[model samples]
Target chain A: MSIRSLADDGATLVASGLTSLQRAHPDLVAISEEPAYVIRAGATPAKVALVSGGGSGHEPLHTGFVGMGMLDAAVPGAVFASPTAFDISTAIRAAHRDRGALLIVKNYTGDVLNFSIAAELAAEDGIATETVLVDDDVATDLQRVDGAGPSQPDSHRPGRRGTAAVIAVEKICGAAAEAGAGLAEVAALGRDVVHSSGTMALAFRACTHPGDDRPAFDLGDDEIEFGVGIHGERGVEVRPRAQAGELIAALTAPVQEGLGLGRGDAVIAIVNGLGAMTGLELSLAHHELDGYLGARGVTIARTLVGNYVTSLDMRGLSITLVRATDRFVELWDAPVRTPALTW
Target chain B: MSIRSLADDGATLVASGLTSLQRAHPDLVAISEEPAYVIRAGATPAKVALVSGGGSGHEPLHTGFVGMGMLDAAVPGAVFASPTAFDISTAIRAAHRDRGALLIVKNYTGDVLNFSIAAELAAEDGIATETVLVDDDVATDLQRVDGAGPSQPDSHRPGRRGTAAVIAVEKICGAAAEAGAGLAEVAALGRDVVHSSGTMALAFRACTHPGDDRPAFDLGDDEIEFGVGIHGERGVEVRPRAQAGELIAALTAPVQEGLGLGRGDAVIAIVNGLGAMTGLELSLAHHELDGYLGARGVTIARTLVGNYVTSLDMRGLSITLVRATDRFVELWDAPVRTPALTW
Candidate 1:
């Protein structure tokens, strides 16, 4: 039997979901449907506005994180598609204050292109904008050729596919902006977070699109799509299904190595559910990851465990580690009040 | 292919999960291994403590709700099982403060029996206690005789199975207790919330237990288990798959009628994901529910949309309506600091 979800259809999914999200958090977020974006509802103090968006289906990634102490606005496209540059530009114009705005874009071709164009569009209207590109997925980092020229075809080395680490980028950078950091300062902070983070994921089952009859991919009984991304796509390789410890290790060791984390290095860890993974499973992974890191003499300064970034309803999870400085830890602990994240 | 989850063997799932949970939210909660209960880590104000728990699958329910402005202690049983009376009494003793303790027990035979015995045990130790039984599920409301006698076997009429409404009860009552309500007053408030609440759930697919090859049940592609419970059991009836509005109406009308909700009646609405349901689906359901209620002239005073209570990874969602009084709304808006819920 095919997996099913309680969605009307793919075409209207994003609009309808935004309506509900705005209704559920009217005090926190407001929806603008003409250009299609969600902005903070209530008044915010004058600070650099934080705006981010990509595709829909990753609920709470951009929209759900729009509230006080987070994004000032979020532009959402249809399910798994990039928001139009016009939509992003309109949201930036509407959300930016005198301090201007910062655009946090995930490392995907369409997202980078659209967000960059929107930044220029906003700048034409006298709105100062800075972009922080998030490309923390270690899975896609393998194809990076040393000293590859900029002329190389984009497909050959797309850089790392951004994954769950965007949560860290958006959260920490949003905190900095909320603290009245200038646009350049906030962008610098976001880039620092992106630089310090790495993410890896695996899926036991693929996600089924809304109204579709079958999942995006299939897996054997004892196989896993290791190093999966956030678009219901298969992973870099197939691996035999093993114990939870081994699976978590496979995802975590690379992230730690990529960040050059060592004994006594503190980090902010995220055990993010792609979509269909349960809190029970995610918790087990975090516990195992904690034990693994502790054995490696690493200290987990803070942790977030939830479906922050999802790939529709894929049954898997990702591990993100951001090497945390005292400032990052302080900002991560800062108060935030969004629909998906709050403190 | 059989449904699979990223879990260890079934026997150690809860323990392993808790270790990770405590690791993730060390500042918010602490876990006791011997009795397997989670309690607020730091000192809480002297007041009537709120203690709750049930089987482990429905995470973020009792355990995840344990922290400030919510559950004081949560005694988790193994997956789909009940904690022993000894476990309940120990948690009660540890959680109770100078004011006493209040046991928030979901309406399951195992849960009721153990909590009742634990209350008595606590009384013997000079610890005053009260119990507020929650039976908000309308599915099992069938077969409940108007004036069933005490001698009637529970099997014949188990009444309603408590589901997602317990979140409102725990949250509202926990706030009251935190604000220094006595045990009797807190218990009375909890009972009022329970009496004012009703929940209905449906599943597109049944949940599979960890280490199990098959699911709890199966459904045809065009069928849904209407009025399903949180334990992954079949619903009260099988219904043809319909559009989102019709499915939502089917779930909401009964709940509205059961609560005697009419024009001008206000409510706190919840679109709770059973397990695998995505936030996209939940948001659409909430939007539909909101539209349905608005057309009927009822105002939704507050809204909560997420997987607050889940039945493992069941592909389903539940709707809960708690008739909102001003005091209930006030308490609902109170500050809370838990891992799963914070504001």
Candidate 2:
């Protein structure tokens, strides 16, 4: 079977999506013409500016999130590709106002290299910056080498791949910065969220890239790619199709174990769609996840179920669990007014 | 190719989705166990209560929309099926106060019959009620049938099918009722919204029913079903696939003419995802649509781009346009706190 995308041109897809986003949310965000960055529209009390960006396909990730109580600026690259170092540095300089800026980079090689280079460039431009690298996808934590914690860099291990846990990091750190936290404190808080979080995904059908006629990968009728990444990459292993409850358990177990969650542990859970997954499916998956976690005595303090971080039209979902502290729960409950997530 | 659903059982899909929805938004909605209806939670002043429901697949429609600024109660039936009159009546009694109630019924045979019956049953229980029947789908306005306006129920025709325009009716009417408007006024506003709105859809792929292995129908790779409905039904015609701009124009032109839109007309535009269409695709489609409307001298007063009303996993989107009035814009700008729509 041939697959197709509504946006036929990959080169123009991000531009069109960004323009439409700005048009729909004129009050919340504005687009810079050159190098293409989304900036928070309305002015507010100056604090540590929160900036983030990644590949274009996982929208609402860095763009739809540029608004009050979230990202101050977001730079989007081409589909499934990292933004240029120049784009990131420009956004950081544009958003920072003496309060310094914090860059939330997902732990992809391209994204990390570009964001780190941008930080150095921003420093040369007289702007101080801190980086919070998110590596919450437990799928990449293969082998789990000694001292290979969420923040530790291990050359032998590729380490964790960032997935939906970035939502928790952005939300919590955004709340902290909005509440007047300093740069160091906000970065520290973000790292804390990443440390307590873990995510894993599975896809029965991979996503077709814009302008492509076939999906990135294919699977058998009764099989699924477990522990998949966000860019339509094949998962770590193939598993036979199972019931929704079993699938939920399969994704949730590793995250629960990675976080060392047990009886009386509180968590903020996110049952996120990887594009084609419906709200009905995500909610049902959440029901299964909630039940499983309850049976294990892990209390859910808050929950989010939707297509927040998607991989084009990949037909799958990821579960992210953040072992919650009182501060985390309070920050998560704080008022947010972003285009994709607001309360 | 076979399409699979995350939820394997159609019988329990609605229940699982609702349980998960209530769990996620406990402060916003509560599930009534017996007949499985979702009702708004939290205390509020007595006002005309807004209630609406339909089949389960078009989610975030009646259920995800149940909150402070939308439906007071939402009764979900099985996928692609209507709730019984008993379920609707129970929900009405549970939600209505001394100010009476308003039932927002989408114009489907089963839904109209059930909601009308429930309205009568509520009357027998000594509660005053008014009903607003929404049928804004221009695709179903076939043959015109001599004086078949949106609200007119001609015996000779099936009448226009209700589509995403129900979101406008429920939202505007909900805001009106929340502001203490009487039932008659709320119902009138809903009907007015229906009269001004028009919607059209196209699908490259059909959705599979929960637990089904195959899709509702099949189509060639280069053809699309134009003017499709929310129940995964076939469209009015099969048309050759075109570029994004041309496809957007194909859907928008008719709705523009159907509403008699011309220079200086303002509208509230909704680019609603049927289900599996990605946010990137939807936004890019919106960009083309915005350019098309602007070239025609029509202005978009407000825009909503998301999957508020979906057809499970159909890979398509519907565009809805409601000619804007001062009151409509005011009400549209009114604060709404629903699970699917909040600002």
Best by DockQ: 2
State the TM-score for model 1: 0.96
Q: What value does the interface RMSD of model 2 take? A: 1.2
RMSD of 2: 3.5
Give the Å shift of residue B73 in candidate 1: 0.4
Can you tell me the DockQ of model 2? 0.70
Models 1 onward score TM values of 0.96, 0.96
Candidate 2 per-residue C-alpha lDDT over A1-343 given as tens digits, one digit per residue, 9 for 90 to 100: 6775576687677898888988999998989968889998877578999999999888768799988888999999999999999999999988996899999999988999999999999989988899999999987765323333345457755567888999999999999999999999999999999999999999989988877888899788888888889997666777887888888898888889988999999999998998888778888999999999999999999999999899999999999999999999999999999889998
lDDT for B41 in candidate 1 is 92
Segments in model 1 whose C-alpha atoms lie over 4 Å from true places: A143-155, B143-155
lDDT of 1: 0.87
Q: Which ten residues in a row have the lowest lDDT in candidate 2 chain B?
A: B143-152
